[model samples]
Target chain A: MRRPISLALAGLLLSASGAAAGPERVAFPAGYQDGFVRYLDVDRPDRKIKRLFYVNPAALETAKAGDPLPDGTVLIMEDHPVELDGEAPRRDAEGRFIATPEVTNVFVMEKQPGWGEAYPADTRNGDWDYAWFDAAGTLKHSDPERYAGCFNCHQSRAGRDFTFTFFKYVEDLKR
Target chain B: MGRCLALAILFSGLASAGQAAEITVGMAAADYTPATVEARVGDRLVFLNDDSVDHNVFVPTAGHAVDLGKQVPGARSELPLGKAGAFEVECVIHPDMHLQVRVVR
Candidate 1:
């Protein structure tokens, strides 16, 4: 009788554990590349979310001139989900989704001069970098002073994301 | 046998007695608060999501990287630094956010 009771208890525990498990895998579709760019909120540090952007270079250049987003870009406002511990997720606010911190990163993927087709590349090996755009959609990369200020901050993330801290979105490519 | 039981109880009590000290580092607007942190080798650093959006904390070099993948507002994360050295801390979601950790021996 005791043995039967113990077995039942064990089975119950196993079921509970299975129910609590998260998704087995997350998939990012092919034909697109993903990365992120970070910026400091000008207002206050205590109340901002780092902006995360997912991009597809193939659709770029075709975008209308002066559009806030480059072509082939899907800007998902993601925040760290408390329940998932370290995973980043998109959040919905009111009718639309707004990423906390209210900032946007501007990235352009220009083809390197000598690279031929069949070159294996992703965010890490891609010939892309970023510039910060203000709320008004002005590009800040051309300013020499701005470049240093931005590059210095991003230098830390160079190894992980070719960025400062936005590499968490590429969960599949992490080494 | 009674002596052994008492020792076991005492050991268990000790194990549960002390809560580790938790320090929260906030990443916002592209910077790490308490950017220069000083702590003993075994101390824990808790990265909090006080900002309105998500942030990712990771180390690029040879150290423990806790990819606090994406933290939403009012959330928090914790990572233990067991080795003593300077670890570069940054948010992967924000390429420009940076923080430095000075782990002392």
Candidate 2:
């Protein structure tokens, strides 16, 4: 009887590649839009899109540059279609695109120690897991190949502890 | 007999014209060394990440866009040239790093 229950528990943790700790480890960070500290706002005039990057204030207060962010670090990327005039993107006084209120998608990259086991060795990010949630905070499109991009793109920045904007946030933290 | 000899020469020329070589480009110092590569149609571009940091290749040339996602140190990936044209290879993370490859049939 004990053996049967243990077998079922083991199956729950196993992934297709025999790895544990997949995207299930990440839950949608409800209310992150307002509660998290906005760190970066990237505008893509080419696509008429704007991305608002946010990090949980806890990480902004504690993380350092050139070092892996703390295990509990949670970073959120919110994408919006920029406000447009006819065919051109309308810009604010600073020349930054004016972001529309309706969010297109929300992507979250969260790190926790030992989460590295979720991916194969070649593409595994140190300890980060990524998830896609709709604007309503419902998780969607959680395929490994799509999520693999998070590891692949971030892996190139291994020097910055596998982050692009986080180091900038760290820079702001120092000042 | 004369026509047969001409056909044989034509076949030989076609066979020798496109051998499809494999060219390796190394990435280091956040740049692709030998930044310009010349390749023939059907050839392959082998990208080797020689840098200590991570790098990626994205060729955004119209009709030939491809993203060779994350390459860690010592990593290698191959991009096959299916058409003949000049395409610019760039790193998604290090936007400034560029490799120009001119392909011909």
Candidate 3:
């Protein structure tokens, strides 16, 4: 009789664990890419410098008032490496890379309730969860530790929903 | 055909060499100039102190810790990013001074 009760308890625990398991991996929201609109272009002299940013409709709605993004807001940035032809990088009149850069990587930030609770005060970026995805939209789990750096940098923008791009998005909305 | 193939190989080698060249970031008053840098495996990061006060670049992350000591005004230090990863660098004395470095292969 004791063995039977123990077996029942184990079964219950297994089911509970399965239910509590959140997304161990998340796929790139491919549909959101097209539905979203590009709001900013950034050029950096550093690695993977040139890129464009896009936002889902929900994020823009909140940008109108310079308010924090609500839960479920998704933002994506596509990084384009400077184009190279053979051994030389193509550069233009102003010394900027000339070719149409192929999409090399995608960075994503999604605001979901209870998402950033796991991070401590020093690294938390509100409710945002960041994922570095490849051009094919496959998630790169190798650098799980680097996510903290993401939050730390964004913390400076805590006033703007922990996002540096919000002010530019708001400027575009005003026009 | 043999000569053309040899040339192709030589050029490819040079291209790879160029890809892994060093990049620089400057430390200025109150902030890291540019504040963010993109680098690659085997590339070296040269940090130049352009401010009046001293600054340091240190990473507390495990397995990737690097402390560049204190850099007085006009001083410089070079660090090679031997691996492909992203690490954050901050001045120990002034927590507000920070730089984000992303290394790719």
Candidate 4:
């Protein structure tokens, strides 16, 4: 028997065609996430980070050795919202969200050799470039002035390769 | 003693019967990797995120409708299949992502 197509289903099908699905606009480093190592999982109540972070292999190794991240190092921060499956948060005993979550956004930080030279000394984040992709893989444009926030946040961790995850990676290196 | 043992055996059987089988559906690069799947009522659906981005798996049907909060890459979410029917699953954030699941008795 043919299942009747309802108005909602019809609407969804129409909307699907116009949805965003390509990362080409921003030149996002596609397929770079494969083989990347997850070094941390953080639950942020204040930010969009519902829970994990992955770092490229060479970048992770560089950070562990207490060296500066070379050009082309990329870090991916995964974003999710808090959700519940029953009484508790929908997560495994280890606190990793176990259910398919609505991925709200993805943030990327990449370093390029000498790229920081173009920025004024006051605004530079070493050679790092930050880009954000919304759930649909569409690039989210941010004001250039606001870009200061990215470098400023990382500046606090200058001793640790300008990244907050450095100390965590140090611990992992020992293990 | 015989009656108590019989009750225990019946409860054990009931528990075993209630156990649900699990199937995994992965969310990857803007879509569900395996867009179609067949399952039975009382089975479980595990939504796995294989994309670098975040994703939410949702179906609109009453009992089958679920809001998989937000899945980071490598994370998983589960839905308990309670009804027998066809469910069209989509990621609300990425309308381009779609999946279809058929559940049987």
Q: Which predicted model would earn the best lDDT?
A: 2
Model 1 clash count equals: 20
Which candidate number would show the highest DockQ if scored against the true structure? 2
Q: In what order do the candidates fall by lDDT, top score first?
A: 2, 3, 4, 1
TM-score of 1: 0.36
Per residue, candidate 2 scores C-alpha lDDT tens digits across B1-105 of 334434533443355455866667777788886688776777777887878998878664433445567789888877777667886787878967889989887
The true-versus-predicted C-alpha distance at residue A52 of model 4, in Å, is 1.8
Query: lDDT, candidate 3, residue A99?
Result: 29
Model 3, range A1-175, lDDT digits (tens) per residue? 4432332232233221232111233348787657987776544333424567788876677655566677778888777776666654454443334325578778888777766554445655786767788878777653445454565566766776776664435653564
Given candidate 2, what's the lDDT at residue A140? 81
lDDT of all the models against the reference? 0.41, 0.70, 0.61, 0.57
Summarize candidate 2's per-residue lDDT along A112-168 as a digit string, tens digits.
766665455666677777888889987786445456556667776676667766664
On TM-score, the leading prediction is: 2
How well does chain A score by TM in each candidate? 0.33, 0.85, 0.71, 0.69
Give the per-residue lDDT digits (tens) of candidate 1, residues A42-154: 11113223333344433232333322223223322223212111343322221111344433444332222221111112211222223344344454344323333333443
A-chain TM-score in candidate 2? Answer: 0.85
Candidate 3 at A100: error in angstroms?
A: 3.5
Where is the poorest 10-residue window by lDDT in model 4 chain A?
A: A1-10
